[model samples]
Target: MGVLLVGGLMACAPAVSGPSQAALAAPRVALEAGHPERLRLVVMGDQGTGTETQWQVARAMAAVCAAQGCDLGAALGDNFYPAGPREVTSPLFRERFEVPYGPLGIPFIMVPGNHDESWLWGGDGASPRGAEVQVAYSRVNPQWVMPARQYQASVSGLLDLFVVDTAPLAAYLPSVRPQERPGGPWDAAQRAWLAQAVNQSAARWRLVLGHHPLYSNGKHGDAGAYDHLPFTFQRGGAVQALYAVACGQADLLLSGHDHALQLFAPQPDCPGTWTAVSGAAGEVGGERRGRRPAAFEVYGQPGFLWLEITPQTLTLWAYVVGEGGAVTGTEIARLSKGS
Candidate 1:
């Protein structure tokens, strides 16, 4: 497996309870240049159920990594169902995450989904400390790499990953009261940081990883009008505005809120960036809700995304896992820009 040089961006103002500034400034390791830079990673989301299905997906991911070699994993979000861990020592961390994914033996770059930040059923609200607890766990587990709620990581000079927390930015969930949100001016700081980072990044590819999708063919639909409601348009407007920075500047926007796997062609709003939703890692959801069309859609089955990035091209594969962890990969997608 190739080395991933992960570092946090310090350009944004820090959150009150996140990692220290010193930790965010940690030095990055340079990749050797004798060979062309190549990186392989798996991206999955909504997978913290600790059920047989989750284990099946984990086994499938392990099999693929064992066969093709994955250097890193990106856990899109909703790591735990219903609510997130109460503390770093919560058994769910071991059973749902560590134990199931141990065989892969790679660090997961993570973001917090609505379920991970919720305090009750139906994922209607956020918990004040749920996201913070997960951030603290990063200090304990090397394989779980969420250094802060939002940070930028450079991966071997091939990809610059901007990981953002969308729990506070989303609008469909009505139960999340203002008091339960993150303290300080988190929303504005994150947007400023991402805009500057994406515009200034010199990496071969710039990708944004978050919990919510700017565009989706699944249940949640798109941001600004989530769930196809006009009322939500006003509440969810922030989400659209936040991601507008990456519309044409970033290479890809990867997210998972709806429980399906989908790949959408670049829409007029975000003409330069492709959108992918891989939320079926644990429980599968229904088919597309008809809000929009997808270039590819997979549901009623567990699946994930595999990406192979080189200096010349960014190739992607969508993998579907069947009963007994039978793995099948198909429908390759590639993106290239003259270097």
Candidate 2:
């Protein structure tokens, strides 16, 4: 339930990926105002398989956590591949788990990923299901935390985060057959639950998170991956879950299915709210096995996002993580909220 969160410092000098095409596209969106910042939150996703770079970044972030007074870490999902944490106590867990963020030791909470659930809950009890998986994960990892499947969580009073699972929505397509779905987040009960959660959260910031991204100019877009299956399904409303925050109650939405990073804002008719795809956490290097459109302005780097929240402004920093867990290329842009 509660974790004491171990804190430490970070090593600087990360692997230089490249310049963000997003910055090259149009001018960088300047912040409304800059000033005294309050909370500094780090966002990392798609690190389930574990990489030397990712592990190094986590180690580095641990130090920033202490200096910035970071209370927790939000793990976007796919925390473990080929299966979630079913083999919680395995040696791979040590190399992949304990070694990576063991330095940070903060309460790291996660949403589900296609890879995580495939191993943990879905794929039949033969894989890892019921209390067995839960017991293994919770009992073994002292720093790990995940809400009930399809649930919302409160972060520091200012934000209420609705963590959604999109697997079901995508699987519902005719290709997959609704009844044939092994598992997915697109459930009727979850829909009702999310609606109620939004209405109840009066926080200044409402964010919905998941593993699959809703908007991105990454390799996952266009041609093949453009299937963006979930976005077009059930009318745009299914993909529109990312837009729940567009109403203004929500400010930021995050995901990481594409294995790349892209920051999005009001493009054409898509108004309100900002979405980010933080899929590149030292895995595929931003190159999804899919084709992305030329119009897509991508960050084109191997790194993660850092969200810095202050009493006045909320800033998102895209940092490039190095092999040793250090992050550089600190670029800060604020999220504007007017009174």
Best candidate, TM-score? 1
With a 3 Å backbone cut-off (N, CA, C), the pairs that clash in candidate 2 are 8-63, 48-79, 56-324, 56-325, 57-325, 83-119, 168-184, 168-185
lDDT of 2 by residue, 1-339 (tens): 232323221211111122242321111111111122354567787776665656556665665666665545677765665555555466655766567766665545456665554523431112213213533464456455442445555544555667666544432232233432322333444555566667667766667777666665655452123444453542224444444433444566778766766676644434566677776664545443433332223344557777767555777777676554555755545676776
- For each candidate, the alpha-carbon lDDT, in order, equals 0.74, 0.52
RMSD of each: 5.0, 11.0
Count of clashes in candidate 1: 0
lDDT tens per residue, model 1, 220-272: 77887677665542245667777898899998899988888888878998898
> Best lDDT goes to which candidate?
1
By TM-score, how accurate is candidate 2? Answer: 0.70
